[model samples]
Target: MSSLTPGVSRLSQPPTTAALTARSSTPVAERAAQVRFRRAISLMAMTLVAPGTAQLVAGNRRVGLVAFRTYLGILALGAVMVVAVALDHGLALGLAVNTTLLFWLNLALIGAAIGWAALFFDAWRIGQPLSYSMGHRRVAVGLNGVLALGVAGVLLFSAHIVSVQRDFILATFGDGAASDATHGRYNVLLAGGDSGAGRWGLRTDSLTVASIDEQTGKTVLIGLPRNMANFPFAEGSIMAEQFPDGFDCDDCMLNGVSTWAQDNPTLFEGSDHPGMDATVMAVEGITGLEINYWAMVNLEGFKELVDAVGGVTLDVKDDIPIGLPGDEVTGTIEAGTRKLDGFETLWYARARYGSDDYSRMARQKCVMNAMLQQVSPASAVKNFQGIAKATSDMVETSIPASEVDTFLDLGMKAKSQQVATVSLVPPLINTAEPDIALVHRTIRAAIDKSEGKQPAQTTKKAEAGSKAKADTGTDAPPTSTTSTTGGSVGSMKDGYAANESEDLATAC
Candidate 1:
């Protein structure tokens, strides 16, 4: 409406940018309302940085005091955790593997999330948002929601991560007394399981004992050929009781020891996995090293694990076959330095189409070494869920839940150390009639050499050369030649190049 009085001007307010922005005609009541609205917004924002501050200044002082104290306590706890971790780097690993503690931590996170969201809501209420203009009120609500949900969402996600770790630990490790280190060493049996390590009617496709120093983390991977025959059993063990002289039965091989024991369950009456027990006994008898724990991997699961890590990098020496010698070819992983996917990696480790058992064993060591070095802690964390799922699927272990942190630490340390391998195959220790005394001395010598206790034994003199001469030997390494028997780089008469390596990394 136009002004009727003389010299009257416009009645409507100017644009928002012009209103009260260096103005002289603005009303006191309207300006006061604006000030209160600004004050309300300021209080809400204070709660975002310092929870309960808004309530302390304007609403409930007691509630604000409680929330503020709780917040301070949490901050102090976090600081303490940081200091503890600084002192002991393995402290977080302990917490991660501890299922009981993880359960509590996850619950605490959930509770903290709820409490934090509640405090944000309280701050919004204390802002007196209803008294503000509708637009201001909407802004206040939106900002309050962002703060509340943002913190809660982060904490909720943390809780979920904790839950995943707890589940993986619980599922993988069993409740048992942790095996103490033997002579300052932890010897764990690594095998490929057709069924599972702890189940009935199982046979190991591959076997390697990962003997590690408890203090230095130096490791020796002793690869036992699956076809090893006529081996003695550890004294006083059930296998020894059955075959006092030696396991010299017709067609009896090293891998069949498990199946043989499982057939006569009465011998291992109280044992869940008689086959595994027998295999461990045989391994102990052969190596003279005490076995602490065992881990078995399913081939299918092994592929998944490799895939989970994005793939394993390998020095593919030749065109590795994918299927058995007699079977039609499924695929081939060509020679040269290549990063192979899960399927390709699995074949690289297991393919025996043209390769002999010993050659395959050599390749197995290569894969193990690659995994130990390349699949890093960072990668594990980055692909945490995939790795966890793959690990649980493919691997079965006898390691106690308590010892997980110890192995986790040891594995990390092992990456920094030189990994050596000893394979009891042709040209070193004959599989058909292996010199039992020589085998023991060879293994001990390897371990001793690794520990700087003794000098390395020469290939001609030693029964099982500690050096991987078969795979990466001086004579033109394994390549596509007439001498290349099967798919591997060496002939059947001599042995596979990978059968033994002084440093597995160099051999592969």
Candidate 2:
């Protein structure tokens, strides 16, 4: 009312003490906000660097201590595993294959992930993010949520993968210790079985003994014709006792032994795998080497395994037929170097049209060599899940889970070495009546050659034939002759038919 001086009015007065206090406090509020933003950032960083540190410093001590200890233990275990893997791969594999250990480890991973996520949430609470300015608070929440989910999600996913692998191993392998290697080698009998309609049990079509050196992993494959007859069983085996005079029945062949044993289960009583056991005895008697373990690959299932590894590449030597017996020919696999799918590979290995069993055996050996050489470690790791599924579905083995690591190591070593093969076919040994003593001597010599103790001994016919071809400067006409050693000579040009050579690759 007294504001008649100049332009002054009662409504327009200067700032009072309270209003000034508020104005001056604006800078202080801004400074507080800045400090809070920094604190929020630092707390999140602490949680990231070392989970539960904020809880230890400002929140619940018990939860913080537990989480911190667990984190430290996990780090320690990871470091120890890295060191162990670097020092001894077999030790790492052993731990991986141990189902009990894998189960506990998977559980620990899940638990740790949950505990770590809880610690992150507690850390955010300890930071008092809600007390901060809106911008700072939002940033803090976002970061905390991200970190919690990220750490927990990754660990949970890894746990799932480990669980899958553990289940696969547990389901696939039986409980037993690894068999002992004999004569500085482990002889694994690899048989390919066909389960067609009306085929009683599994009719083993391919028989090969992979003799692997215990130390160097140098391997020799000894292929036996499925038609071989009049063979004795391993001296102390049940089959040997039953047929002391040898498997000499008029209609009984080597491959028939498995079916006969299955039909007459009482003959192989107390044996869990009577068919495979009987076949193992026949193989042992024929090869004259102890069979440490046996694996039968279902040929139909083998296709899946091949496809799982992304198909195998091989040099096809001849046009192979692809069709069932007594069925119309679907197609023919043209001869060339090509990558083959599961179906094509199966046909390539099992085709009997325009070929005999001996030639098929040679082709199978080539397939085995190609697989061993071509499946690289990188490719295997990339396709681990598919390969695991295929192997579990296709293969039936007596090899135990505990021995997986040792065999894995040996397989890796074997990959670096050359594979030698010896097939006892028509020109080498008569399948009608195999010379048991001569078979033992030949197998021993092949093993010695593989170990570098002896030279490769080519047959006289092969030597003479090669010399005649060289002398003539043209292909020698095919001829057959009965030898004094009870073997029949045949053409070597026809895809290693009834021929034995030091190098299977060149022989075929």
Candidate 3:
């Protein structure tokens, strides 16, 4: 046609076979390339959705069947566990504190991670990357690697966290049998203790009893000052036998009970922690509530616990000094509602430069309240390792492994309620010779109020403020005749404003 163009006034004819092939070859090639690329991605995707499905169809069937069976078995076991936990919730808790179970769980996770990763690699190999274009091969490999690493990384991380939890439970929780609640309440003695060279061994500077309702979980925090004196021990207790009538020795304050027990351990037979047992006796005697368990925290190492929970938020009523009396001040916690770090929170709870011990007790109560209310479950999970490490290192408790989950649930319940507090400090009760009868009655009333068995009573701080205002015929803060303590909002002579409050949050 080209040569005879002038004479080729003839009509156009159908395209030649070569021309047709030339026209369709590029499009056909592109479509074939697309099909191969799609097949590669589909194989990888099948592995992601159902771990050995790609291999079952396109690769070795034996390996695929084994992997698929393992995957199904794991899923079925998980479903069975969910049903078991639903029937007996305590089974989950038992597993949580079970080191043996945790160990096996860790192993299973690791094995699953390795097996799943192998399946992904096998699926990748079956994709036959060489059959695809260079660009398609690169994309498919990247996707396979991401999927493998992501799944393996998650499983490995879970194993690591579970391993940490197991270690923590092993070291921190004891294998003692759980104790039943006393009178539908569980009373736990919490103390902040310290020990050092050339110092009295294990002196608890802060002592408080958290009496929790067995059903409702409402709590009454009864704080006994470290300086409290002339208290009796529970009848038939070692301390009681030692001091037939009461602990009336000169300079033998409440906090010294632990040191005294440590000095004479022979008196506390069958007890691993003689000092803790002695303190429990004293707290039981003072509060008239049986101690279900005790948890003592090392004051120096408590900062780690605070930091582990991402620091607790507190209201700093005054500028609190970081150092003890006569020591060089390093930092100051300024007044106002503040979120405090570990160091600052430790000082806030222990600071007493210008403030007295009573104010420190009040501040410690504030810290306990803040920790209970502000520490969310999300924070616990996010900082689980830090928390586990800190607790293992800092806390010494007699809580049985079985009771850990019960208390955890109770604590969650308490967090939503307004906590009631009563510290046996000045004005309300004389620390030097505290009225034992009054202490018993006060503790009973607080617990009753928490259980809703008794009507609400005004806090001692309110009563003192009213009395002071009545005396002065003014509505000013009860700062009459003296200025406020350096680190507290109220004077030592007047009751600590935070000592006995119906609602601790506002009182602090």
TM-score of each: 0.86, 0.84, 0.85
Ranking by TM-score: 1, 3, 2
lDDT assessment of candidate 2: 0.79
For lDDT, candidate 1 versus 3, the one ahead is 3
> What clash count goes with each model?
9, 0, 0
lDDT of 2 by residue, 169-257 (tens): 87767676678999789999998888667652368888899999989888899988899988999989888988999999988998888
Ten contiguous residues with the weakest lDDT in model 1: 474-483
- Native-referenced Cα lDDT, model 1: 0.82
Q: Of 1 and 3, which scores higher on TM-score?
A: 1
Q: Quote the lDDT for 466 in model 1.
A: 27
Off by over 4 Å in 3: 1-37, 76-95, 133-135, 195-201, 455-486
Clashing pairs in 2: none
Runs in model 2 lying further than 4 Å from the true structure: 1-38, 132-142, 195-201, 455-508
- Candidate 1: where is the Cα deviation over 4 Å? 1-41, 195-201, 455-460, 463-492
- What's the distance in Å from true for residue 153, model 3? 0.7
Instruction: State the TM-score for model 3.
Output: 0.85
What is the descending lDDT order? 3, 1, 2
The per-model lDDT (C-alpha) reads: 0.82, 0.79, 0.84
lDDT of 1 by residue, 1-508 (tens): 6545666555643457666564655466566657777887787677777877777898889988987788888889999999999999799889789899999999999998998898888877766777657887788788889888999999999999889888888888877799899999999998896654565237789999999999988899998988898898988998999998788999999999988988899999988768888999999988888899988788767989999988999988789877877789987889889899998998898888766787788888889999999998889988888898888887778899999999999988999998988877776788888888778777888788889886455334442232445556634333213345544556556665555555778766
Model 2 has a clash total of: 0
